[model samples]
Target: MPAPSPLRAALLAARANLAPGLVLQGFAAAIVAGYYLAPPVRTALERLAVFRGEVGLPFAVVSTGIFGAVIPFVILRLSAATRNRYTLAQMSALVAFWAYKGVEISLFYALQARVFGEEQTVFTIVAKTLVDQFVYGPTLAAPLTWLVYAWVELRFDTRALIADLRAPGLYRERIFPLLVTSWSVWLPTVVIIYLLPTALQLPLQNIVCCFFTLLIIFMTRRPTGAV
Candidate 1:
C-alpha cells in the first residue's frame, strides 16, 4: 500500500487525537468562562503588583515559562524514562517559550493600543484576528515554533539543521501540515483571548499554554500506528 501524503497523514493524526483535542478545547472554553465570571481570579492576578508597568514584560516571561515549559517538564517526569532529569531539548523549548511569550505580550499591546487603538470592539477584535491569523501567526509564531522543536529533535546539531533546511519536500511534508493543524487550534482561541481586557490576556494565555503543551505531548507520544 502507498504511504499517506503529508496533509492526509496530518488529518489522520488529528482525527486520532480528537478526544484529547476536544478535552483541551473544553478546558480552554472553561478558562474563558471562568475569567469572565470569576472576579476574584482577575482581582488576585492584578494584586500581584509584579504585573504592573514594565514589570509586566518580565512577569509574562516568567509566568509563561512556568506554565508552558516547567509544568510540562514536571509532568513528563512522572514517566520513568523522563524522570529525574531534563534533556537539552526540553531546556531549549523552555527558553523558546519564555522568549516567545515576551514578544507575544508586546505584540498584544501593540495590536490593541497602536494598530487598532481600541479594545473589545468589533473592529479591533476583527483586525487583531486577521493580523494574527494571516500575518504574525503564520510568518513569525509558527515558524519560530517549528524551528525550536526542529532544533531540539535534531539534537542541536548545526550541521543537521543546515541540511534539513536544504531538504527537499520538508516544507510540504512537514511544515505546512503542522501550520495547518496549528491554526486549526490557535486561531479561534486567540479570538476569544483578544476579547478580554489587556491585563488578563497573558495570564489566560499562560493557563491555556499548560493544556496546550499537554495536548502536544499527548499527540506526539502516540504510537505511529495509533493514527
Candidate 2:
C-alpha cells in the first residue's frame, strides 16, 4: 500500500477537521455576539480582565495552562476512545509545554499590540491577525508545537529524537498538516480574539483553545461497538 503524500495527508486531515472547525468558528462568533449583545457577558469578561490585572501574568499562565492543557487532558482521559492513548508523563509534559505557550502567546500578543497598534479598527485587527496566524503561528508556535508533540510521541527519548530529525521532509510532513488545520481553525478565531481588548484577548484565546481541544478530543471518539 502506498503512503499518502504530505499534501494529500494534510488535506485529508483538514477535511476530517472541517466539521469541528466550523463548530469552533460558530462558537467563537456566538461568544463575540453575546459579548456585545448581552450586558452580563460583557460584564463577566470585564471582571475576568480586572482580576487578571489584579493578579498579574501568573494568573494568565495558570489559567491558560488549565484551559489549554490540563482540562483537555482530563477530558481525553474521560473519553473511552482516547482514555488510554496518553500516559501520565505525557500529560504532565503537555501541561508544562502549554503553560510555557501561554506565556509565549501573552508576550506575542503584547508585541503585536505594540507593533500593530491596539485599536480595534479593521486594519489593526486584520494586520495583527495576519501576522499572528502567518508569521508567529507558522514560524514559531506551530513548529514548537510540532516538536513538542513529536518528542512526546517518542516518549522523551533523545536518541530517537535525533533519528527522527534526520528523516527527509520530516518537518514538512509533520507541520504542513498542522499548519493547514491551524489556519483553518485559528485564523478566523484569532481575528475574533483580536477584536477584544488586549487584556481580554488571552482569556478569549484560553476559552477558544479549551473549546477547540475538547472538540477535537470528542471528534476522535471511537464508533459504537469498538473494542
Candidate 3:
C-alpha cells in the first residue's frame, strides 16, 4: 500500500479528533447558550474580565498555562511512562508555549474588539470570526503553535526539530493538517467567543482553551504508529 499523503494523514487525524473536537465545541456552545440564557453565567463570565483587567497580560499567561498545559499533564500524570519523559524542562517549555499563546490570543482579541467595536451585531461578530479563523489563525496562530508543540514533542531537541522542518513540504505534512483541524474545530467556537462582551472574550477563550488543551494532550497520547 502507498504510504499516506500529507493531506490524507491530516484528514485521518482530524477524523480521529472529532470526538474531542465535538466535546470542546459542545462545551463552548453551552457557554454561549448560558451567556445568552442564564443570568448567573453571564455574571460569572463578566467577573473573569474584572480579574483580567486587574492583572493585565499576566492574567491570560497564567490562566492559559494552567488550563492549557498544567491540567492536561495532570490528567495523564497517572501514566508512569508519560510522567517519565516530561520533566521540569519539558514542563516549563509547555508552560511558556501556552503562556505565549495566551498572550497572543488575548492581544488579538482585544485588538479585534477595538477594531470591530464592542457591538454584538451579526456583522461585527462575522468580521472578527472571519479574520480569526481564516486570516490570523491560518497565517499565524495554527502554524506557530504546531511548530512549538513539535519541539515539545521531540523533548526540545533542536537538531531533530530542525531535521523535521527541513523535511520536504513541512507545511503540507504538518502545518496544513493542523490548520485544517484547527479550522474545523475552532471556526464555530471562535464565533461563539466573539459573540461576547469585550472583557469576557479572553475569559471565554481561556475556557474553550481548557478543552482544547485536553484534546491536544489526548492526541499526543496516541501511539506513534497509529498516528
Candidate 4:
C-alpha cells in the first residue's frame, strides 16, 4: 500500500494530538485567568524579576528547566498511550531544553533592550514578533529542536549523525513536514507570548513546551498503519 501523503500524515498527526492540544490551550487560558483573578498569584509573578543582571538569568534557567521536565513527565505519565519510564533520550532532551531555554531567555532580554530600548511598546512588540518569527524561530529554535531529537534518536552516535545529515530527502520528507506541522501550533502561540511582559514569556513558553514535546512524541510513535 502507498504511504499516506505528507499533508494527510500531518492532518492525521494533528487529529491524534487534538486532545492534548486542547488541554494545553486550556491550561494556558487558566494561567492567564489566574493571573488576573487571583491577586496573590499575580503579586508573586510580578515580584519575580526577569533580566535582572546575573540573578534573573539563573532563576529563569532553573525555573524553566523544572517546568519543562515536570510538566511533560506528568502529561506523559497520565496518558496511558504515552506512559513509560523516562529514558536517557528524554533526559538528554531535557538537558538540552534547560540549556536552550536559559540562553533563549537571556537573548530575549538582550534583543529587546538593544532593539526596543528596554521598554515594551507597540513598536517593540512588533519588532520582537518579526525577529522572533522570522529570525530566531525558524533559523535557530526550530533547527535546534530537530537536531536534539535526531541526536537522541541516533543514540549520540557521531557516525550515524553524519550519515543522517547526508541522507536523501531528510529535509524534504522529515524536517519541512515537521516545520509545517509545528508552525500550526507555535506561530500563534509565540505571537501571544510576545505580547506579554518579559518576565511572563519564558514561563508561558515552558508550559507550551510541555505540550509540544508530548505532541512530537505522540506523532513519532504513531503506528505505521494507523495514520
Question: Each model's TM-score?
Answer: 0.80, 0.90, 0.88, 0.77
**Per-candidate total of colliding backbone pairs:** 0, 0, 0, 0
Which pairs clash (backbone N, Cα, C closer than 3 Å) in model 1? none
lDDT of 3 at 134: 86
Segments of candidate 4 deviating more than 4 angstroms: 29-41, 50-54, 74-86, 117-123, 220-227
lDDT of 2 by residue, 1-227 (tens): 99888778767777887787788778777877878899999999889889988988787789888997799888777879778867999778878887888888888889999998889899999899889988888788877777777677666877867876787897677677777767777988898888888888898788778866554333333345532
lDDT of 1 at 93: 68
Q: Report the lDDT tens digits of candidate 3 across residue range 22-55.
A: 8877887888889889999978877777887999
lDDT of 1 by residue, 1-227 (tens): 99888888767766665666666667666766766688985566566534545575777777788887788888878889767445856666666765676668666655665768656888888888888777876787666666666655555667867777788997776566666666666676777777766666666667767766664544334233321
Residues 1-227 of candidate 4: C-alpha lDDT, one tens digit per residue: 99887667777776666666667766776766667789987776676533333476676677666666666677677878657635646665766676567668666756765777545567776777777767776677766666666665555667866777788877666566566667666666665666556667677877787667666554444234431
Best by TM-score: 2
Between candidates 3 and 4, the one scoring higher on TM-score is 3
Q: Which one wins by TM-score: 2 or 3? A: 2
As for candidate 4, its clashing pairs are none
Question: How much lDDT does each candidate structure score?
Answer: 0.67, 0.78, 0.78, 0.66
On TM-score, the stronger of 1 and 2 is 2
